[model samples]
Target: MESNSSNPYKDCLVNEERRLIDERTNVGTVEKKKIAIHMAQSNSDNHTKELDLGTKTPKPIQPILSAYPCTGLGKDRRCFQPQWYKSFTWIEYSITRNAIFCFPCRNFPTQPQKGYLFVIGYQKFRKVKEFLTAHGETNGHATNVILWNHFKQSLIEGTIKEKFVALTKSEIMPPGNAHYCSPPLQNQMLSAAGNIILKYIASEIREAGYFDVMADDTRDVSSYEQFCICVRYVDKTNTPKEFFISFEKVVDLNAESLTKTLISTLNNNSINAICVAQAYDGASVMKGHLSGVQEKYRKNHKMAIYAHCYAHKLNLVLISACKYLPQSRKTNIGENRASWRNFCQNHHSSENNDHIRSYKIPIDTLNIYL
Candidate 1:
């Protein structure tokens, strides 16, 4: 009931004897050369789903006299022999077409020129070896070789997901000194490696039984509040170590929010159970007994002892001393103070005034003992 006028398989004669060698199956003879090659590659790839071992060196296929008919005469009436097939790895002889083809060029042809043997049959037997050698030395052939090697090496390294390629000869040997990876690509690779290292460090810290957590929040130049967390613990050798683990953004700087963020980070690293102590700056929200971060944390973990930073206490004391101390005023203290006051009141001379002016302290500095 099908009309022959619109038949898709009209020109493709499907031979039942040998299906693989039919003209429809040959990628080189088909109008859809690209599609045929893609389909053939996909089918082959589906079968051999294993790591590419870059060592797929070609072993010359042995051709028999009956199977590969070479009795056809060339331009010079010379008959092709089995010795010609043994000479090259890329050369593939066709018995039906009486032609020779380049295997590598046919499979992975590069740009500009895909080589004459890739498109047309090479039937001239007089100088066949010369043409083969010339085709092997082209830029396209070298590029294809590099591509094949890179694909195989990537599969073996288990970095097929990363899609990292091996450095080419031009990149390795150079005045260039740099590889082909862009800045963004390099950052991505480094980020992956950094994540792996962080996981390892986290695991090591979790193995230690007890540790102390130190946290502080600061506003950066961009006005973003970032809270930094550090852990101090002893290793298997009993060596004390402190490690800065994480920096988290603080959307809300209240006791509840900061406690939640810190607890979340600890839980993520699997170290929430082993915390023995907590340290933070002497902010009212952190040190307040009723509704402080320390108090909130103790609701979950009671054994964690809270400690205010001594350096922060010292800074507050210094600020108080500077604020209360008078710079230019002198109070009466001992006999020295009375003596100095008597001398100043009695001797109202210009020389005494010059002497007092020489020792007078500036308003900016605090003279605590004066």
Candidate 2:
């Protein structure tokens, strides 16, 4: 068989034709079976090669399986360094003497070294260990306990006290301006801040000579009984300022109780007695003639009047008009007729009967002649 160069499909067919001829000549009737087996083996090899190219090999990662040490000298102990030793030389000296001289050095320590241990007692020693641990230094707990005990012993012995002394004047003030003393002044400032709001309210009331006070009782979010006393007044420049003077938790709101609270609050603030006017809603308890707050004040100050609330009076008038104008009448003609009949019935009695008879006789004579 000859291959065709111009067409690729014809060329492949020619190659197959040559292969079949070769197989037939070499193996006779068994040639087709051998060729099929060879082609199957080649396809299997190509498939395996493709799979190998697509497969991935995993890499190993470092493991963190190490446990903390059982013994005192662990990794944390190896990295431990006492931070307090860096600042004070006495600490370094004590450590060196403890390591070298042992018991002899403790019996014959220098004056300054004993004094330093006395001031930094057990409490301070424990605090220093905490400070080291907070800054990433570990394994100082046991050593801190030992040092703290030693320092506490040094405080008990007088050998540590005679080493150093300081003379402090009575009422020694801090350096710089007096305002710079923040520790004590901080408390003062806190108290002043509390009073600032109340003082401001008083100043506002003082500037506004006359004010109307509104008093009411209400419960707060915390379920505490509280009295809300608000002041409405105009300032010197005629600008109105309305603010709460008192919103405080109270035990009771009885007449005596409320009056006592009012007197105390007014007197404490140096407020004039006549400058304040009280206004409240038409509550029976507040305006009752005998036992109400209005009556109580009227006993002392007769001018203490109870003005009828205009809004309530207007409501009464509207109700009366609606009751008289039933059936949605444009004009109350029925009401007028009823009013005229009642007037005539009341006026036409024994004295008015003679006047009515004379007027009727003239009317009758005129009617006959006509």
The C-alpha TM-scores of every prediction are 0.39, 0.31
lDDT of 1 by residue, 1-370 (tens): 9765622221121121124333344334453444444434432332234322122334213345654433212123444566776577656654433556665565555664333355434544546788778877977777866765665575667452233334342343533334536678678877777677667666777777778888999998899999998888888789998888788999899999999999999888667446788888888888778999999988988877899865455444335443554652354335466665564354446665455456552322322211
lDDT of each: 0.60, 0.44
For model 1, the superposed segments whose C-alpha errors exceed 4 Å read 1-183, 314-370
lDDT of 2 by residue, 60-167 (tens): 111222331111111112212244444421232122111111121123233332311222111113134454344223223334444545655656653222321212
Residue 67 lDDT in candidate 2: 34
* Clash pairs (backbone) in predicted model 1: none
TM-score, model 1 to reference:
0.39
Off by over 4 Å in 2: 1-191, 298-370
RMSD, every candidate, angstroms: 27.0, 38.2
Candidate 2 TM-score to native: 0.31
